[model samples]
Target: MSEQRLIELEIKIAYQEDLLQELNKIIAQQQHQILLLEKTCQLLHERMNSFRLENNDEGNEQPPHY
Candidate 1:
């Protein structure tokens, strides 16, 4: 291949590699965010259950309408 053509090919390959790395990083960040959100939801659910149990012990009037 001509020298210019080889250089162009190298540049293209480098750009593609960089793009792939960026995409991978973004994917990792999104996964982390999803995991955090799931944990938050789980905690919220637990808290709600605990509050309900506590309220039940006192025989408080059930809140009108769920």
Candidate 2:
């Protein structure tokens, strides 16, 4: 290959490497966000279950006709 062609190829490879690094960082950040969201979802699910149980206990009251 010509000298100019070789330089062009090298430059292109360098750009690709930079892009790959940036994409990797973004993926890592998204993974962390996903973990945080999952934890929040679990906490909300637990809270909802507790609330449901509390309501069920209160629901045991008989009507006024008793």
Candidate 3:
């Protein structure tokens, strides 16, 4: 293979490697964000359930404007 062609291939490989690393970093960040959102959703769900239970305990009080 010609030296110039080989050098071109190496340059392309380097660029591809750099792009892959950048993509990996972005994916890791997105995964972390997804995990955080999942946790927040779980917490909100639990809080809502607790609120429902509390309301049930009160046994449907009449509206304050009643």
Candidate 2, residues 11-63, lDDT tens digits: the string is 99999999999999999999999999999999999999999999998899887
- In terms of lDDT, model 3 sits at 0.97
For candidate 3, give the lDDT of residue 2: 100
Model 2, C-alpha of 45: deviation from truth (Å):
0.8
Local distance difference test, each candidate: 0.96, 0.98, 0.97
TM-score of 3: 0.89
Which residue pairs of candidate 2 clash? none
Off by over 4 Å in 1: 60-66
Instruction: TM-score for candidate 1, please give it.
Output: 0.74
Give the per-residue lDDT of model 1 (tens digit) for 1-66: 999999999999999999999999999999999999999999999999999998898677766685
Backbone Cα, N, C clashes tallied per candidate = 0, 0, 0
| Candidate 2 off by > 4 Å | 62-66
Higher-ranked by TM-score: 1 or 2: 2
Candidate 3 scores a C-alpha RMSD against the true structure in Å of 3.3
